[model samples]
Target: MGEHRDDLPLVLLIHGFPEYWWAWRNQIQTIADAGYEVAAIDQRGIAGSDKTPNSSDALTLAQDISAIARSLGASRIVVVGHGRGGQLAWAAPALAPGMVEGVLTFSAPHARAIQRPGTHLTLRTWRHVLTTFVPPLARRGLTDPVSLEHLLAEWSAPGNDGASSQAQIYAAAMRLPEAAGISLDQLRWSYTAVQRPTGRRYFELTKNAIEVPVWSVRGQLDPLLPERAWRQDHTFTTGNFRQITVANSGHFIPEEVPEESSQIILEFLHHVAHQA
Candidate 1:
């Protein structure tokens, strides 16, 4: 593959579930302005990218990353992922160590095993449950206009901000019930495969000690990922990691606080590159 340009280092920004490349609208422009070659693609079944018939298990998603990077002519890259994409960020490096140069994740645990210590983690497990159980019901409900709006509102961040339009476009792309949320078929297949023993093995590989430098960012007020809960989790490597807590943001860090989010990423990249 041919490089886009020699002056700019390639950075592959991967999006989380319920999102496509549009999720990183704020970060993409900022990174590009800073003179980096940035390419943010829709993950499978998300947007302009191909929605393959196979399961969207963690390994399949990670392999997609390798293909995306190589297709963009990136010999190695500074990879960034958020939320569910953060899970991919952790997994991709361990699964294909030689291809990734640096890693950054936001608002979610890296490939570490799910450690449910108390009611909170157990309650948070609803994400998996809902995705598994409600997709069919959701598909049916989405057939209604009112239900479709509700689904879009739920999948999207609920606030009028700079990123709100981007969120709307993303929500419109779901199109399962004609621009609602994920289809029952997508949900059923993904959940079935991800819950398997082999799926657990792939996640284990992602959590395996990533020798490359890593950064984790979270917001103090994020509802989905509470600061206290994340602080108590010990799955990631502490010695080689850095954590930044934004004062009053939420799980959707990129949208909640774009400037701060972008700044933290820029700083981490500079520090890691200098150390290298």
Candidate 2:
């Protein structure tokens, strides 16, 4: 969304489940105006992006982020994401260290942290994860405007004025052919892949601590991933790692608090630049 400059670092903004590039509508220009170039993409099967079913595993998804940065002529990149997208950002540095210089994630924990024994995922989160196992039902719920609206409202902080508008946009995008199904498939892989050989390989590859700087932000009121889920994330990074909890915010950190989120992101970007 901003001009690509040789001197300016490229920031790739990735949206999470039930969201696309529009999720970053508020922050795109803000980051660009701060002297950075940004690209907010519709990951894999969401929105207008190609629907590649059965190929949305962690490895493939992280590769997609690296591929996009290279295509954008970025020598080094900062990847920012929310929700599931944030999880991917956590893995990108390990999977593509040459391309990724830093990561800033909103409401996402490290992949290993989520998979550890006794991980603290809320009941609502488990319900959402289980729903993906039922393809037909999950697809329908994701595409239905009423259902989508309810889910967004349930996850967002109280008094969030943008929830309804965000739900409408995401619901419309899900109605695209195969979008809902593919989105569910991505979620399904996140859980079920651990049982497969490929998933084992992925974990092994990312087992070592990430070498790039990482900044993770989450809402104190986030129901899906509570404080316990993210507390150990600092252990996953060998480089600079910082975690911030925003009071009065929920799962939808970026949309719920765009101004504060942008400031946090810009702060991380400046930190990365200084370290480099």
The model with the greatest lDDT is 2
User: In model 1, what is the error at residue 212, expressed in angstroms?
Assistant: 1.0
Task: Quote each prediction's TM-score.
Answer: 0.81, 0.95
Which residue window of length 10 is worst by lDDT in model 2? Answer: 1-10
Give per-residue CA lDDT, model 2, range 142-238, as digits (tens).
Answer: 7888888888878988877555567777888999988888888788888876897777888888888988899999999898999999878988888
CA lDDT, every model vs. true structure: 0.64, 0.86
Which lDDT tens digits does candidate 1 get at residues 1-276? 233346434788887655677878888777776667888877676655666654355677778887888887777777788877776777777766677777888876654433344444434445644745765565445445455444434433445243444544654566642223333444443345446765766755655577677888876655555555566434465436777777766566787678888898778667666656
